[model samples]
Target chain A: MQPSSQMLKGILEGAILQIIQQGDIYGYALHEKLAALGFGDIPEGTIYPLLLKLQRNKLIIGVRRPTGNGPDRKYYHLTDEGEKTLTIFQQQWHQLVQAMTNLNQGDESS
Target chain B: MQPSSQMLKGILEGAILQIIQQGDIYGYALHEKLAALGFGDIPEGTIYPLLLKLQRNKLIIGVRRPTGNGPDRKYYHLTDEGEKTLTIFQQQWHQLVQAMTNLNQGDESS
Candidate 1:
């Protein structure tokens, strides 16, 4: 199951950064790859805007690649900043998980 | 280390709800518990506003209880809707973790 919009709100950017970090990918193609990886149905509206925002923030950069059949595709690639962000995201995520584990286990005793 | 504000924005509400669900707690006490649980240094300004918003949304309700030594403590509890939200949050969280795991693993193979 996919997350609620609210849940996805904070997480999607990091996920997208991670995806782009793996390799450069275009906007539409990202959805397919995200779905294949089990993120479920992500809307183009959400993806494009976040991509623009990431570029504005210097976390990612888009390179226009020519396609014979269509307009040039803006393929996104992660910047070093984005890689650092992903590392922080991973650490924070695991910390939250561990803390939650402690909290849940503490339920029995407290 | 704590998550970035952007990362925590969507998650704090559900975490607060889960905390309240586990036990009736006041705003200040919630922080101590949250920090203890390793959510890191969450500020009072953030918690109070969220508590008010949750109450406004009817997900949580606060009851003022008398404390002999101090002002009344408004303790929070979850509504039926809040419980359902918590369940969904748990499922969504697990789904996200699993999906992220898949995405990362795919990197090695693809």
Candidate 2:
């Protein structure tokens, strides 16, 4: 079955929090990572707006960094608040996966 | 390790696309679903802007429906382009999980 957009939002939010917890990163680099991870067709438009939202929520802060080549890039770093949020998101994500796993297991049992 | 914000953006984008692929839904309902799924701390501000972006990209279209008791709410439905994107995303997400899983397995082996 196809996952609903609502379900996708939760998953995405969790994933986003998890990514930010790793290190400071810029938009293009992030997109490249996603593409490298096999999301080659993922739209280039989605990331910036989401980044802005994440920043607005105080979960992340942005800094301008000079690139070796071309223009300065905006890189995002996780704040303390962002770290706390990631912890919560991680716990929730594990619970969700466990619940889904159990449900799938039950389906197999029946 | 904590995920960087850029990484989070990709995960979230894929997740959001997946959710819309499942069914028609609105911002509040999507947020509620996220909360139910364990993202209780997820800010209410991020979703609408993302939704608008998705809509603007033509991946989703909105319809306003009256609630049984209050005001009408805007619901988003995935377009054909959205479904195609989801297929690509799912393929990519599976690849990501497989790669990560393999890496984890390698770590355990070592």
Candidate 3:
């Protein structure tokens, strides 16, 4: 089931952090990676602004490098703080999933 | 990892809906159930307000009934709308879990 935009909003930041933690990536590449991973068509409009926010929050750092094909691209990589945040997000996510599973399974009795 | 208040704010509405779907329950019982499910110390100040919002949104209805032991308790039960919302939430949640799982595991390759 695809998520509505509202459902996606809270989880997106953590997804982006997980991606950046893999390796440094540029905005456009990040967009494509999300799509490739079955996230559907997440517009650059959505991702670029989030990247800016992550930068503003000091969870990531961006550096510019000349791309042979065009203008310099800004690449994002996680900071130590980003790693810590991702760890917390992962734990919260797993716990949530487990609890939800138990709740749904127990619905028969309730 | 326990979820922070910020992480939970978005998903709490859905969780509450799931609980109501299980059975009609009052505010205090809902609080205890959440703690039992590992949702950790969610206060009534947080839950009661969300219940009001759900009723306002037409996703749930509340009925006050006398419990032999004490003050009337307001029991919350899901509406048709609540059932629909919970279905969507469950779908979105599972998909998000899959994508996150893939991303984290793929971190080795990226």
- Candidate 1 lDDT by residue in tens digits, A1-110: 11223332457777788888888999988988877766767779878998999999999999999999888899999888989977776666566666666666764221
The candidates' interface RMSDs, in order, read 8.2, 9.3, 8.6
Assess candidate 1 and give its lDDT.
Answer: 0.75
Proportion of true contacts reproduced by candidate 3: 0.23
lDDT of 3 by residue, B27-47 (tens): 999988876765556789989
Enumerate the candidates' DockQ scores in order.
0.25, 0.09, 0.19
Top model by TM-score, which number? 1
Please estimate how well model 2 matches the true structure, expressed as its whole-model Cα lDDT: 0.60
Which of 2 and 3 is the better model by lDDT? Answer: 3
> Model 2 Cα displacement at B7 (Å)?
6.6
Q: Give candidate 1's error at residue A40 in angstroms.
A: 3.2
Which pairs of residues clash in candidate 1, taking residues 3 or more apart in a chain or in different chains?
none
CAPRI grade of model 3? incorrect
lDDT of 2 by residue, A60-101 (tens): 999998878999999888888989877776555455444333
Tell me how candidate 3 scores on lDDT. Answer: 0.75
lDDT tens per residue, model 1, B1-110: 11223333457677788889888999989978877777776779878998999999899999999999888899999999899877777666566666777777764222
> Which residue runs does candidate 2 get wrong by more than 4 Å?
A1-110, B1-8, B107-110
